[model samples]
Target: MKFTRRASANWKGTGMEGTGTVSTQSTVLNQTQYSFKTRFADGVGTNPEELIGAAHAGCFTMQFSFLLNEAGFTADNIDTEAKVNFEDGSIVSINLDLTATIPNISDEQFQTIAAAAKEKCPISRLFKTEITLTAKLA
Candidate 1:
């Protein structure tokens, strides 16, 4: 399937002093505030890295669920944290920490499925940086 999504940003003034607002087509983030301080320093609001991490975490977790179902297992709980490591104005790597509770699944099976899901997830595939994952089954 082919589809599209949209988000917009507006900024005023210089890069270091300017502030911007980002909004999604769905209005979930209706002109959410973002500023230089928010991105590079401590400030209230959101940053691009956190947004990307959240998106990656959400996408990978959902893809994992789909894989578990296909493998004849269902997860009772799945939690994932995507850590984006940035350096020298680039995202160097992403680490996905995942914990899942599934019924009647072997450790080997879980590991295999998690690895496959990590590779198959759309967000994971989008990144050229190294992606590492640590998955635990509980």
Candidate 2:
């Protein structure tokens, strides 16, 4: 019922000229900076926010797929994009955009299932921030 991951980071110089290494016991991320123009793809390492977004999106989509199946529907593909914004040393908002290609479902039913998935998803339960989800069925 509990899971955890350990990651480490090291920074040199100031925000602009500084670079850092972020590593986990399994993954080593080096030469990454959260300053200037450096970000998820800006360096050789990945940032925490980016990783969080990826985790949230991936988790939500998989949860949605399972929930839909339980609701007598199936998804051909479920893609989610998550955005997390930070401000004043806190996460401001978490936005999720989900596009699903589902079969044998009406819009109302899809919305119902998607709403249940959003509420029941493990990642959705983990964060205590404002989370917005836009679900599109195609």
Candidate 3:
């Protein structure tokens, strides 16, 4: 199976002073504001790195849940945070912190599943930089 998602960004003005709006086909982000201030400085809009973090966090959590279920365990709750580092005008690394609550699952099994999910997630595979996962059972 194949699927495609699309997003568009429109920018105007100079780089330092320019402003842009990002729109996605899903409409979850419609005309979302982003600018140099948002990316390089503290501003009132979202940035590309933040978006990538969100995607990674969501993808990893979902993949972990699937793995848990396949291993005969059901996750009662799963929370993940992806911190993406963007430095020197390039993406450096992404660190994922995950906490999950599942019944009847050993710590070793959970760790194995979490590591597999982190390694095999589509979003994780997209980046060439280092990706780290810290998982804990809650």
Q: Answer with 1 or 2, whichever has the higher TM-score.
A: 1
- lDDT tens digits, residue span 14-131, model 2: 8767777666667544334454345624655566788789889989988998988888877888889999988877888899998888877898998888888889999889999999
Q: What lDDT would each prediction earn against the true structure?
A: 0.96, 0.80, 0.94
lDDT: worst 10-residue window of model 3: 85-94
Candidate 2 regions off by >4 Å?
Answer: 1-6, 12-17, 24-45
Question: Order of all candidates by lDDT, from best down to worst?
Answer: 1, 3, 2
Model 1 gets an lDDT of 0.96
Alpha carbon lDDT at 107, candidate 2: 87
RMSD of each: 0.8, 3.1, 0.7
- Regions more than 4 Å wrong, model 3: none
Q: Of the candidates shown, which would achieve the greatest lDDT relative to the real structure?
A: 1
What lDDT is reached at residue 32 by model 2?
43
Clashing pairs in 3: none
